[model samples]
Target: MNSDYRKPLPGASMQGEPVDFFDARQAVEDISPGAYAKLPYTSRVLAEQLVRRCEPKLLRDALTQLIERRRDLDFPWYPARVVCHDILGQTALVDLAGLRDAIAERGGDPARVNPVVPTQLIVDHSLAVEHNGDDANAFEKNREVEERRNDDRFHFINWTKLAFKNVDVIPPGNGIMHQINLEKMSPVVQCRRLDSGAKVAFPDTCVGTDSHTPMVDALGVISIGVGGLEAESVMLGRASMMRLPDIVGVELSGRLAPGVTGTDMVLAITEFLRRERVVGAYLEFFGEGADALGIGDRATISNMTPEYGASAAMFYIDDQTIEYLKLTGRDDEQVALVETYARHTGLWADDLDTAEYERVLRFDLSSVTRTLAGPSNPHAHLPTSELARRGIAVDYPRAQQDEQAGR
Candidate 1:
């Protein structure tokens, strides 16, 4: 461990003072302290902000409002840009089209309503690799299949692209949205020139229609994946309201075993965390174990935020973060700015002690074995040896004959 690395950060609180900013200690009183141990990663991040930003009266008000009145509260959410892959993007648009018709029937202009925030829709995720590995024509064949199946959806998307404001379309044949986000999008620290001619900086936060939006969390952006209905509400400038959540600090120890891809590690972690029931909490991955993983590996874990049912899987600012920013073509100045801001703001991994989570979970990398999850859910782990017991390995020659004879 670096001696100078793990110091308390300055100006770490939203109110600029340390006053038990989400009252993790107090909130745990109403519920069993042990219950806090099970919150998902997403809920934890939200809890952190509610503690830091919500006014005291509003804090109690906000907490009770939803549970008591069930009313939605408007809070500030500034997503850098809305990201969508083709499938969900198309479905979301279909809903919007329905909404337009509903508005027209109510004597409102259908064309007048639009996304209030900057939105980017990418045509990825519809491509399935029916063809095998890296053949010269594989990309072409895949594109053909994609275009054929998605023609109706594409036609609507084309209309949407021209009809809507604040929307940009990245056409098909591009890579996955998260990969593109890492490669080209996501300015680690966003800067906008204010009307007074001074530059202002705030944390980058976003909500994507897809559940994997947390992939960008590896870059220190506060992002969450929401359902289309929830996203539509957010798009219309509504605040997502809620009570404070339990933020769980996951202390990872030891490096991953060799030949283990980030995917494998994340799969293992996903199963373990799900069994632990950390749904809706914010999970911060830190320690020597976290420091050792490459940014790509961190992203793999973060990308599965939905699989583990956590809100955000965050890896704090560190040397690996800086390296990823550079590798992804971020400007040198912006990269330096990220380090400066994080170090100053206590957002850095080292600055996080007395960082105070409602709960904590620990994991050891060495104990994870080669495994696979699912006959259904990603969290359902079915060891290979159990296949026979699960009936997955049964002889099917007679079953095939019965099906052919319609018996």
Candidate 2:
């Protein structure tokens, strides 16, 4: 055991002490360090497990599986649950409906092709924020427009609501999916009965079709946003396999200035991290700065993991994670169990040591400025000072030219 190994956390004992925790790289060896350099946060977690769990000789073979053929690997991904907002959920169901048609044409039973996993779809994304700032009828008017514009989509979704099994649909006019997940959907700790009827507690983990799925990571659940293609495979019970990634430890220091919203900080970090090119790497944020951020703020940052092109932006189980579980309406007993399990199992932030990483990055929060990202891509940041340079200000001459052209 390394002398640096921290003691096991309080309830994390189900897996044993800190010393017994798996070494990320001990299971796999001798790959070009450069290749690991660019793997994203989500890829990093997948790699770590593949290295630590698979047979030693097959480690390299397994690592190369995704890289060599781009074929889906056979691994176990027990997602806590599946989440979707209406647009993508509807589209995914449409694909399934179309697949059903294809399968039926091929002389297979379409009814047998239902999702094997529990799926939740919310109808929220289509609501345009056309009306703003607490208008009494804004929601109603928005709903009306939403219904008109999305008639075809809704017709299909309504059909799915009745036709699909192992699926639940949250009708329109609810809050955003991420917010709802934070407020209602995600269960910080999940319970399952074993074959012998003994209940077991494990860390909650899931994959959402939307990129913002990582928002739940702030609650210490290992949730990630995946593309529709990859999600389809997982939906059908396929393991997303790959080599271990370079775990990048990002140490955030300092505090945001007053009046700076979490949004501002995230936009700034997105710009900085993108410049550093931590693409396709698993990022673990730690230090005094992380402690300073509220769970909501952390969720905001984690939600944008895809925007930065990384896989999982993870914050380890810590006081923040515990507090979030409480704030989000998780049962007190379950929240306590999460704290207990994480501490005992060495999954807590403080217990991570031999947990090796290929690289580390430092960020100073005090330096972040009030900002927004837009016009084209989220990474194309336009600091307020550079707005004129980016042609954001209206040009009266050009407007006049366009007005005359219209006439």
Candidate 3:
């Protein structure tokens, strides 16, 4: 939004004072009174980011493109942040360090080079399983192995902590990066002070180095995974330019039957979505089935988004989200902010019944049974009873003979 169109946040401030922000609600309302809430969660987050940062010349076109679902026109999106596990994070930092040396060699101020946005790396990728699960000291033993095995890499990671700005490192054995993000790193709503002395409230949108990054999207964040090179570009404040994706509304109805866990449901849904050729689509799940699921249940589905080849799997913020925040030990005030911001910005699940999608597929959770996924493909749904037919329960000697005969 232009300066002339900016409005103050009702309960937000930079320093105990009111703050002005680009009123995304007003912008979409200018398009149509009922337009804002009808946008999919993914689309709403994308629109807000564009409204906040897109150039004046390109702003209207971009917003119109998204509002109308014009897949023909491409647009630019600036993620609020970037997340990474040690494997990619370490490499990116090393590249930056190398770049710094190259700059110094060119008589430039090497120290001036740093990430322009918030970047966090968790040392989650490597750890030796030196202790078995039955051991009482398993976690400690694992940590010991991790520290010893990754001594050199950890040294470099520690150096980067002091060597660079706008970077935070979470030590190994903390948890998986996706789990850490879900449990702590990601704030469902982000509040930041902009250069104009305004504190803006927006979704916690991000891109990670692992595809399962969408796990946080269950909390209403617009998170997705990108490769290291792409992640590096985003870390340096580059816009992720792209054409609009096919946003598929997956209307989940009915409840899961007895013995049908959330995992079974996800496997079933993944198989269903994959079969529908939902590759690269943004999937938004709604209806009584989706609403009945807790945040953890939603996370199980979102975490496996890549398994079905979809770009993101998102659930709109709702009471489950609020309850989850409190259960996870988030401060009371922060939890309240999430609700207020989501409600006001048209991102709340209750506000999205009218959301529109050109293409849609429906799945019945009740039809989902106790399932076994696969020996290979994640979306390959193999019923436990058919394990033998799928060669998963084959006779050992027969299989060995067949293998020896090169069959």
Candidate 4:
């Protein structure tokens, strides 16, 4: 960690005192006056991590890329954690064991090999649903089938949990991995103690083994999906190399119509973003419409990020985020820490009023109607009203005739 940017974090600590934090906003401003205020939310968070973790020699250049919005040079990003499902998680652990064997053969201590980053492996994907949902005991029956079928796999997975350091295993039937990460796994902000006996707080960032990992982005955490190999590398303590991405600003305006569900709005937004060609871009959503959305509603949009071809769909840390943290059973002290850190570090939603974006897309929430996407592709957006015109819907008489004729 660079000492130059380190400063005291202003917040009531768990012991009722201030915590230490890296002052990224001040560091950015010192280099380029007034530039930090103009950075989008994503940039600000990236800058903070750069300040906290980048080598002192490379710090300036890395931050300059963010300040100038340049993607010319690759910078290092150290994710706070890694999330995985049983399939890839098992493969990664097997690779680690192989590496340990190789190390022992080379006269090195195999015991020293362990993941530097914390990893959580959830067995949510391997379960088979043997019983129908209508059955009252379907969940239990399905779990039993999963246990029987995946006995060997489960044994290996359970062994990994005990054999590996920094690995936490959530056994099968816990919940969907993404939803678990959103509501329980991610802390929104993380605080740690250094070797020198000082504490520092930073925003939570992670890379998951699944595409829908960006669901935590709704909580203002910078989470993204990675391939199995990349996830393995990160687990082994390698920084994920990245150049600054095309950060696009999406300004949501107006409120949703009464009775409109978040599903409809997300489907509409997904189609709109895909049409605008947001492939591989990091999108920051803000404005009156975004402020009005609850964390659940924001998560609805963020969960479809890959379908819309965006890398991350991020929101700012705001009151809704705070409320959601509370509703999800987070401790009051931790919730206060999140809000305090964000506000002090210029990551709060209100602090970003002056943030500027290179490309701004305006979307009206009220314009969204009941919608559906994809008979085949998720991007195939069709409002309910257009279904008949598009020949996807038939009149009652035609439907009856087709049903009778079995056509």
Among the numbered candidates, top TM-score falls to 4
For residues 276-382, write the lDDT of model 4, one tens digit per residue. Answer: 99999999999999999999999999999999989999999999999999999999989999999999888999999999999999999999988787657766667
Q: Which regions of candidate 2 fall more than 4 Å away from where they truly are? A: 1-80, 98-111, 129-135, 371-407
Runs off by more than 4 Å, candidate 4? 15-18, 104-108, 387-407
Total colliding residue pairs, candidate 1 = 18
Weakest lDDT window of 10 consecutive positions for candidate 4: 9-18
Q: What's the TM-score of each model vs. the native?
A: 0.70, 0.72, 0.90, 0.93
- Which digits, one per residue and each the tens of the lDDT, describe model 3 over residues 15-114? 4656555667778778767777778878888888888888878888888887878877779988888898999988999999999999999999998888
Instruction: Single out the weakest 10-residue window by summed lDDT for candidate 3.
Output: 12-21
Whose lDDT is greatest here? 4
Report the Cα lDDT for candidate 3. 0.85
lDDT, each prediction: 0.67, 0.68, 0.85, 0.91
Residues 1-407 of candidate 1 have per-residue lDDT tens digits of 01111222333322232211123324533534443333333333343344444554555444343223223564333354567777776676777778889999999999987887666788887888888766889889989998898898888888889988767788889888888776666776555443544344334567777788889888877778877767766666565664344467898899877766565577778888998898987788877888888888888889988888888888877888888889878877677667766565456667664355556788887655555675467666555556667788754687789899999
**TM-score-best of 3 and 4:** 4
Worst 10 residues of 1 by lDDT: 1-10
lDDT score, candidate 1: 0.67
Between prediction 1 and prediction 2, the one with superior TM-score is 2
Rank by TM-score, descending?
Answer: 4, 3, 2, 1
Local error of candidate 2 at 348, Å?
Answer: 1.6
Clashes of 3: 0
